[model samples]
Target: MPPGRTVRFSLSLCLLLFSALTGAFAAPVGQAEFERGVAASQRGEHQQAIQAYLQAQRAGFDQPALQYNLGVSYFRLGDYAKAAQQFAQLTRDPQWAALAHYNLGLVARRLDQPDRAADHFEQAYRRSDNARLRALAASALDRLPGTRADAGTTLSATVAAGYDSNVALAPDAETVNLSDNSDLFIEAGAVVNHRLSADSTRARYLFGGLHLRQYLDVSEFDQQSLRLGFNQEQILQRWQLDLRAYLDNIHVDSDRFEQSLNIAANARRTLGGGRDLRLHYQAGLIDGGARYAYLDGWEQRLGIDSLLPTGAGWLRFGYQLELNDRDDLEQNGEFFSYSPTRHSLFARLTLPDAGHWRYTLRGEYRYSDYDDPYRISNGTGTTEVPREDHRYLVGIRAQQRLADRTALFVDYRYIDNDSNITAYDYARHQVMGGIEARY
Candidate 1:
């Protein structure tokens, strides 16, 4: 053979052999890259994992597991749009469809698209054969704004049995004729929200609730309340705003107790860094029942609150101011007034979820100064003095998930009311445990 031909043949043969070797090792290299990506992801190094995953993809490694991991890495990196895109592509596979839809729901929720989130959750719930996944999807659906009860409706129901330390809310030093000062009670409540219309920026709903409490030993203290309302929510500029109007009626011992018409408006603003601020105003016109006509009043309240995210949970704190104007009447030549200006401070802390368990702690303090004097019986004589009240409350609740939309909860509350008038001072403790279901 000629020298030139021999040299060219040898070089070409070597290049062909090298190419064959590279092709033979490509899959292994891709798999190694995928493994590295998974390891980085497990270490919470999402950015590093993303680079390895992209390298694997470039090496022609196309796998469902790889795809899922890549999507999750993107999600962890706060690139929700890219994560959503990756997940959306996997929905074509039967095995991955449920999971992909579930992740898409999470992305939509993070983006504040409730309707889209609900749709995705519902799809996941329907398509999933795995019980745990279905339950998770249902729980996600329950958390959405207007899709709980049924499509376009929100519903929740709870039943509890508890003991009240002071059924009459009477002071310890009072000498009133009462059959029972403490009682065992059972309570049930249901709330419903039905969506009327919705768009990207605004939504409307019809909302209502029913609550009933029965005392085992103190029948006269049994109470029932029914409320019906309408709510409108909208986003304007950087604020989300809500307007609500409702009519509420209360019954005690099977007789009418009080009735009120209420209106409220609230606005929420995101302050970045996982914090939010809310401002609200509420007004009501109250009418007392026949036996308690003197309690008729007009009430107004203004409040501001903030929500702060913690590494392990969240903190919510608020302040409220209340103005009350009630009837000033003279009965049997005795004067009475129920008006007061009240201030309230409240706080709540919600702990991080531990598996399917959740917990919260809350406290509140209130101060009230009466606008008019009350005729009090001191010793053997009646004296008129303006009433001042200080109220304190602390509570805790723990909940355990039982299913997709059901949970068992235990709650405890303590209240202490100190008032200048002895008749209104009281200390009370309540413990309740119950089941709650949402749809």
Candidate 2:
């Protein structure tokens, strides 16, 4: 065999035998044939290895490692179906179950059975104690056509401190109300997922999250938000469909600001070579506080997202159309209706990891056009003009993994808004650092 191929086989077999030989086994009657099979495999004579291993099995010398070696030989010979069968037989052996499942996943993928591949990979990820194998299985699961609920329930939390140049998104320092501040924020979330199909192609999940933010000097800008949601996903061949419903509540300065109910649906299709295309739609109803009742509205959005490979990284692009219709637009001294149509474009680049660090860069642009002109009252009296706004955003983030379940990250973002109305134009910059832990 080629040196590299021999080394690869040796590494895989070593992992397989790590736990398989912990218990006593009877003396093999077919020891000679078994040794011959191992020698044949070392010489890259996979057909000869297969014949020898079969003869050994017939002589009552069956063992987990023997079956594993047989499966590997069949795989090398391009007999994926037989390889899958051999691996399946080892799934009952505790020591080799996860390893068998991992190999079965590879065979399934080669046979063009993505759903089965996902199932096997999920099993391997859930059962394996080897960190490298678990990571490989998880990566395979992510690239497959389905959602895996094998992880069951999970809890996560995050906290960060950051500075914001424009805390209220005001146009400029000369605007009516301008504030720059630093704040601390914390978030906690939980999710529970259950499989709904025996084939592992359908699942339902419940999720909830809470976020709180406190500004050091701006008590009136403190914010809190809560979200509860449910999601269902189904996989069919190369297509995956997701349905979601959620409720959100927001409070600012200890006063209720907004409450909303939202519904969304998405469909994604794999286009080969780690590429994917998705289409989504969302609708929501918004209710506002007394001072912001004029902003109460119904919102609708339709969007598309695509992922493509760019050298060693991935490029993601998205476009969406948004429409908002306010219930009572001419309230609270607002002269014009608060209805608008918006078009948004966003793109992100995720670069390959370098050593322990990973990097991402993103940009977004949005244009909004209102149905009626905006009116503002000033010292000179009332001014009116057709309302239009443009917004640009860019951000970069870097993360380093400190351990298996821990990471540290730093991020920076910039935003610039231009509008025919000065009160709505603004420029801002922000920076933040945070650490995350998972269990």
Candidate 3:
């Protein structure tokens, strides 16, 4: 089908499916009335058919399926709000929530309440099992308000634990190449959002996270970290200003604690499409104090992130220049100074699907260089050099319509790594599959 027609049909199909689920003949109206209504509908007697359907409904025919069909008929009769209302009701049904959420997004979109549409689309994208439909909804979200006035604050958390075959003490330094490894990593996080002005001229967002990791291979390699940060954005029409601060603390089970504080303020240009172009610089100091295995360091970075439209796709391109200066705190004359440059590119696409489904694809490439880097070994007498390398990754995701959830996915990645000191090169490829479920 032509692109133009495809969009039109997608809309119609959503309405039809949602309505059909809510409309059927009412009980006690008798089979005869139902047949008459069908005959009338076939003969273009829509008014008569509607009356018969209502009679059936009034006669106690209120099954869930009947309700859906009635709603569809009403929608076909040009009653959108009624259709929306019906779809909304089905959003709670275990069997119908997926399609219900999709239709709900359409209803909200037609009503000119884009934020509501966005919320529903997000729901649909997260709940649907159809890759194509979820992808479409993800794209739709980008068109909606990235920062809506009434948007609810979001909270997120992650917990990860994996068994490692090899764990080293300063793997970059090749201090010990111990293969017997045991480590567990866990994190918890939360965030809150507040709009500081009626026009959103000023806004503040706050977040915090906690991390704990333990390694068995190194015998006594356990560490914990805590983070606190806040960013305030000042809106100056098309231009934007931001102020940010962060504190990070690291506690080692076998060593004393170390911490870092960083403060940064930056300016950004609105780049349309829920994106921005930013130029930023940051300065910070890391201090291990008098009782640590190594000396502390000074760190600084200059960065630029520009949203660019590439051939057949849109991408975020960014580059960072970093400087690090460290003095040996434990011993004299063991100091190092280094600088590194990093660049990254990311692209994303979301497309519509048949039957309320959607799909999404994203690709990313990143490269980094270090001037004072040394070799890294993988426990088995291998050396790596501090050089330039890149990582390539791609992900494909899908959302289902009938169930209002994401049920499938495909992902792939490739990595090329070279060490500075030992001149070691490591390359890897990976593929993954994932599922999204909603209740």
Predicted model with the maximum TM-score: 1
| lDDT score at residue 283, model 3, on the 0-100 scale | 74
* Highest-lDDT candidate: 1
Candidate 3 minimal-lDDT segment of 10 residues? 328-337
Instruction: List candidate 2 segments past 4 Å from native.
Output: 1-148, 173-199, 328-337, 378-381
User: Model 2 Cα displacement at 7 (Å)?
Assistant: 12
What order do you get sorting by lDDT, best first? 1, 2, 3
Question: Model 3, range 128-238, lDDT digits (tens) per residue?
Answer: 555566566656665554324344454333333434332332333243444443343332233344443433267776756666666544545567777788878776765
Task: Please say which candidate is ahead in TM-score: 1 or 2.
Answer: 1
Candidate 1 has a TM-score of: 0.70
User: Model 2: per-residue lDDT, tens digit, 1-439?
Assistant: 1224433643366444724562466245866787688788878898998899899889988777778888888888889888877788766554566677778887876776665676578767655656576667766776654334335555555667787777777865446453443344433333334433333567777877778877776668788888888888887775679999999899998888889999999998755444568999999899987877876989899999987755646688999999999864553454775778999999999775565677999999999998877666666666678889999999999998766456788999998999888777888888888776553
**Rank by TM-score, descending?**
1, 2, 3
Candidate 3 has a TM-score of 0.51
- State the RMSD for candidate 2: 12.9
C-alpha lDDT (0 to 100) for residue 405 of candidate 1: 62
